[model samples]
Target: MPTKPPLIHVLHPGLFTTVQDLGRCGYQRFGVSVSGAMDPWALLVGNRLLGNPDRAAALEITLHGPELLFEQALTIALTGADLSPTTNGFAIPMWTVVAMQAGSRLQFGTRRQGARAYLTVAGGITGPMMLGSLSTHVRSGLGGLAGRAVKKWDQFCVGPAPRTAAQSIGRSLLERYRPRYTKSPTVRVMPGPQSDYFTDDAVQLLTSSSYRVTTESDRMGYRLEGAELPHRASAEIVSEAVCVGSLQVPSNRQPILLMADCQPTGGYAKLATMISADRSLAAQLAPGDSLSFRMISAQQASELFRSHHAELDRILPPCCS
Candidate 1:
């Protein structure tokens, strides 16, 4: 008989738990959202701990995390947020590895920084995909286990363990790799194609004034309440493709930062776009946190983005060495 896979049963569903991979790409032409882990850095770290591919599927835990019971021994890693996680009453280190024995109970406490956490196992979380991704887009009712957050009694299967056992990550690696979580994040921005539509004062306010994240934020977008920007030509622009960092200012004058599940197109005038490199900072901003945008030339933004990736690459161990 084939060996049975380990099973994880959810006892408490935490604040929210969703299955996520890198993202659904190439289907935006079909109007599908590119939903994935909100904090990609955290997801990558979790996968690195397990020696899985960088884009492998992992469980994205939001705010509070769930309580689970394991049916068999397995290696897992938790990244993002200081959730004070424990296994069978023993504390487990973040950005590292842990071995859970059969019947052992795993739980996470309150979050200290950021909102989400990524839990990755050795062989990745196997699941059905919608439009080439296992990520959950709850608002659209697509992807994930059933187009929603993991619920109580929900069970997930784990693949066979890798030949190498989980081990402690080096302190030097941890010191050099983690992203800095700030109370007030300054996100780099590039002026948008529609920036000319806004009055000079509006543009100045966008870069000068600080904004507070609203409670209405979600995976689709983060609505910011701050300096109300006025448009020079109140006329609507044709809907154009919006990406993960597009700052769309609706008629109400409030700016909404498009996120992982944002629509492909919108009518709002885009004042600026947060650079792809700083997007992970946006992911960590909780409601009521302050944020500011610093304008940078597109060329400069691209260079900074590339440099950021290179810095991260330096910390990652060689995959084939």
Candidate 2:
């Protein structure tokens, strides 16, 4: 007989929790947005602790976190946001792998910091694969567990634990790998493809002024309320392909930084693009959080990108390689 898959019974699906991986790639021309973990670094850390591959699906917990009961033995790790998690009522440490007994309850209290967290089980979360990704594009209603945030009573199948010997204290993620979400961060950016469309002063305003994240922000984009960016000619530009971190300035003049769930194309004049090195920090910003931008040359951004990946590999040598 085929063995039954291990399950996790969700007692409560807090705020907005969904399954995510690295993201669906190479389908933008077909109009598919790469919707995955907003804080992918957290996801990577969790998976590394559990000895799972980089693409393994994990729970992306937002604002609040879910209460779960494991129906089978599991090894798990939590990363990113500190939601004050507890296992069977005992406080559990973040950035560490812990073995869980069957029937044990896992819960979260008030969010201490960070906007989103990641929970990775041994192996990974099992779900239908769409377009080579398990990530959920909620707006499109595609991928992940029925393409929605998990709900109470939802029972999810989990892959079997890794065959290799389990980690001891080595599963603890190093401090350097842990990201800080409590402070107002200055994000780095490079000129966008349509930067020429904007006035020189508009670009200066973006880099010089502080912006507050608005309540209208979501996984799709961070709408900032700050200095207006006037166009040199017109704010309208030919709809062009955009990517994660593309800063699109619409007619309203308030810039919206496109994110993980951003559309495939946009018509607004592009101002700047956040560097890959700072995307994780951008992911942790909550509503009302203040942030500023620093301009960097394309060469500097590329070098930083390489350095960031190197740091990840150093932090999790076993998994990143």
Candidate 3:
């Protein structure tokens, strides 16, 4: 057999690390979850730094980041939470590309603010895609490296960097490109298909109460603890397809926001759906963090989503150009 290509080995798996791309869409009909990067913004920014496509698979590290030893030279970028990343005792800049030599060690410390960080390699991390995506859905064993969290001694191969010279982004662009973690996020929500099932007071509480994210949260869903939302209908609704940001209200009246790894369908009555634009923001929320939802009309939600896409266009260079 031919000798296998060299691969970067995981020295320390940090808090949580998973392989993610844009996501596995269009397979929901087959009951596959759209598993993807939790912090899509970070994933995109990191990819751009390395001149890679937005949909490329990268490593999504949560809370504490990972430490790896590269088997070959490669260009990489880090975005999202500041885990105080350093390479072989030298600090690496965030939202910018840096070159890593073979055998060099990369380490990430505890996070300063947000929960997840996205690390993108130049040509993106090469991996087998299940259901057309490399995103890991541990619960269902659908994608990624055998469908689970990255393990120590696991090696990953990276492709070559772009032939064009790496361009440095201006400080102004850097400031504009990064995600804002300084302020608490106010997520936008749309009244659900079953909103009328809940009392008006419950609707008020859903928007007014400050809910703290419980430690029970994960890639599957965010379990919140706060004011109970009273549903006028005591009976269960038939299970239906659930998407990212579906706020499902269980029998106890507590809301759980379904996430990237959530099941394709759900039985719980959904009270609201967070707009697609804010899904990335919702993913950065950690346990003990407080969040509030503001209701918006569908028309307004569509406009906001368009505006976000426009902003992304401004940052990324044209594909054909």
Candidate 4:
């Protein structure tokens, strides 16, 4: 008889555990949010560490993390937020490949730094894909494990372990390449499509003052409490295409930073848009955490984005394209 396939048994589901990949792209015209890993660089690093493709599906843990029991021996990697991960009662290190024995339980404790983390197995997680991706867009119930967070007792069918996965178990990323999660982070931004709608003072306040992340924040957007961004005219705009990192100011003047699971379109005036390079870092911010924005020219932002990806590629080159 053939051996059964390996599985991941969820013993305790944490705050918001979901399976994610690179995310769905090119569907925003019909109003589709690109829901994926909060930190794609972290996910990519873990995937590459395990000899998997950069877009391999992995588990994305937010704030807290879940306890999972592996049904078979496999190598894994943890990246992103330092959520105090442990395996079978022993603490495990992040940004490094760790070996898990059959029936071993991986768990998380206190959230020391970042707001999210990624758990990448040797061959990544296998599941039904939607729109060519496996990311979870919970608001619309589109992807992931039934388009929702993993529940207690839930089990996931894992893919075949990578051939070189065992050999890379002890490998780890260099210190410089690993990201540092801070309670207060400064992110770079550029003029938005509707930047002119906001007064110069509003833009200055945004860049000069810090905003506190509100509890009401979620994958959709971060409700920031800070100096109100006064608009030049009406606060409303014709519902227009919005993407992650859009700093949309509404009637109350508070800015809402659109995130990974933000709606495809919004009707508020955006004062600025966080650059793509800094957008993922926005995910590491937790409620009560404060963040400041620094305005930069579009050219500078584009150059930074390119340099950022080049560094990420060096962190962990994919075993295959």
Which candidate should be chosen as best, given TM-score against the real structure?
4
Query: What TM-score against the true fold does each predicted structure earn?
Result: 0.94, 0.96, 0.93, 0.97
Better of 2 and 4 by TM-score: 4
lDDT per residue as tens, model 4, 227-306: 98998889999998888889999989999999889999889988888988886678899999999999999999999989
Cα deviation in Å at residue 102, candidate 1? 1.7
Task: Give each model's whole-structure lDDT.
Answer: 0.82, 0.87, 0.81, 0.89
**Over the stretch 1-321, how does candidate 3's per-residue lDDT look in tens digits?**
754554779998888899999889989898888989887877877776666777778999998888899987777888877788999898878777777888899998767767888888877887887878888988888677898899898889776556641553321135766777732577999888788778888778988877888999999889999899888876268888888888988889889998888889988788899998887777888998878889998788899889988887788652321
What tens digits encode model 1's per-residue C-alpha lDDT throughout 65-162?
99999888878888877677899789887777777788999899877777777888877787787888888888878777888999999988876655
Off by over 4 Å in 4: 1-3
The collision pairs in model 1 are: none
Candidate 4 clashing pairs? Answer: none
Leading candidate by lDDT: 4
Instruction: Note each model's CA RMSD in angstroms.
Output: 2.0, 1.5, 2.4, 1.2
**Model 4 TM-score, 2 decimals:** 0.97
Task: For model 4, give the 10-residue run with minimal summed lDDT.
Answer: 312-321
Error of 3 at 223 (Å): 0.5
What TM-score, to 2 decimals, does candidate 3 have?
0.93
